[model samples]
Target: MAFAWKAAGITYNRYLAIAARVVRRSLKEGPRLQAERRGEMDLRFAKWQNGKQGENKSLGEANASAMAEQAKAE
Candidate 1:
């Protein structure tokens, strides 16, 4: 029964229109959507760099203070 249906091309053009519409929609949205996504990633990276710099500065200060305390004790 399944082989008979396959021989008749039962599903050959079943979803052709739907597949075309999907392709068109993706072509329409691809560039603009990708640009927006890239912009979002750039903004996230900027924020991360800012936070990393702040943390590094804080750590440096803490280390310097600890070193100063050690020197005073010695």
Candidate 2:
């Protein structure tokens, strides 16, 4: 199966990561634990820059750190 987000350059893993974070923050104690488990998906990916592939990191850390860098850039 495919999702519209994928066509917008978003991966399924990233979509799930974002959803899991939201669910985790909104759920109650018992359900929160289960949602946190859903958030535990660790994934690796690569990026090309100037035709060279960059090293990989966990999906969450990669996106968070990238946002942090962009915030610093602005």
Candidate 3:
């Protein structure tokens, strides 16, 4: 059987994100705040070139800009 998210043309990551958001929204005040904190993406990444690592960058910032660029292109 085909998955509903696949039928909707969203990637698995996107589907999970949507489901998580729904679950978080269903929580009461205090627990909802904690659950939202858990959803935060505090990730760091670095580029590698010629066997060397570059300075670390915020993954959230990277993804935001990438999505922005893609929107502009589209």
Candidate 4:
């Protein structure tokens, strides 16, 4: 989550605020804003998963490792 925030330069809460703004503006502009928001979110996730430029393993792999450890512990 911290990595996600750093990758986006905005925390989840800040993203929510931006989302609210986008929604309000979208009411006047229509559904195009939704696509824009989705694109931006995808870019942020990609950046986080890639680690500066996707040079590292994906977030899925990270989460999987964590889950595997937890299962082993149990």
Candidate 5:
């Protein structure tokens, strides 16, 4: 069984983003501001190798770059 988003030719991440945006827009002004702030991806991640963790990097940036690479490949 194929997912609806897949049938629509949209990635799962893009579908979730659209759903989140719709939910945020449906909120009242104050709560919407809070929700928008909460949606901000200030995430950080580190690569682990040999039981050692590398320096932290922005997860958002990494994902963005990876998506760009995928787009290029496609």
Candidate 6:
């Protein structure tokens, strides 16, 4: 069986990119400022397999990268 998103034909990253865009657009200035800062916090995910944490890239970086990729594809 295919994954949920795969079955729907959208990758998880694409889903997240769309969601982030919608959320950012929905926020107003007061909360948007706080949210953007929260978004910029460098967070890393770690699973036991590699015994190493992932690189420190902010959500802003990921969002920017996704936007850049979409821009290039257009």
Which candidate number maximizes TM-score? 3
- For residues 1-74, write the lDDT of model 3, one tens digit per residue: 89999999999999999999999999999999999999987889999999999999999999999999999999
- Give the lowest summed-lDDT range of ten residues in model 5: 36-45
Clashing pairs in 3: none
Error of 1 at 22 (Å): 53
Per-residue lDDT, model 6, residue 36, is 70
- Using lDDT, rank the candidates from best to worst: 3, 5, 2, 6, 4, 1
TM-score of each model, in listed order: 0.24, 0.41, 0.79, 0.30, 0.60, 0.37
Writing each residue's lDDT as its tens digit, candidate 2 over 1-74 gives: 65677877888878876776887889899999987876665778888899999987688888899999999999
lDDT of each: 0.53, 0.82, 0.97, 0.65, 0.95, 0.75
lDDT of 6 at 1: 81
Which of the predicted structures, 1 or 3, would earn the higher lDDT when compared with the native? 3
Q: For residues 1-74, what per-residue lDDT tens digits would candidate 1 score against the true structure? A: 56544576666454554454455556556775664454331111122454563322344556678999999999
Name the regions of candidate 1 deviating beyond 4 angstroms. Answer: 1-57
Model 6: per-residue Cα lDDT over 14-67, one tens digit each: 887677867976899999877777665465443344676666566666778999
- Evaluated at residue 74, the lDDT of candidate 2 is 100
Our tally of clashes for model 6 stands at 0
TM-score of 3: 0.79
The 10 consecutive residues of candidate 3 with the worst lDDT sum are 36-45
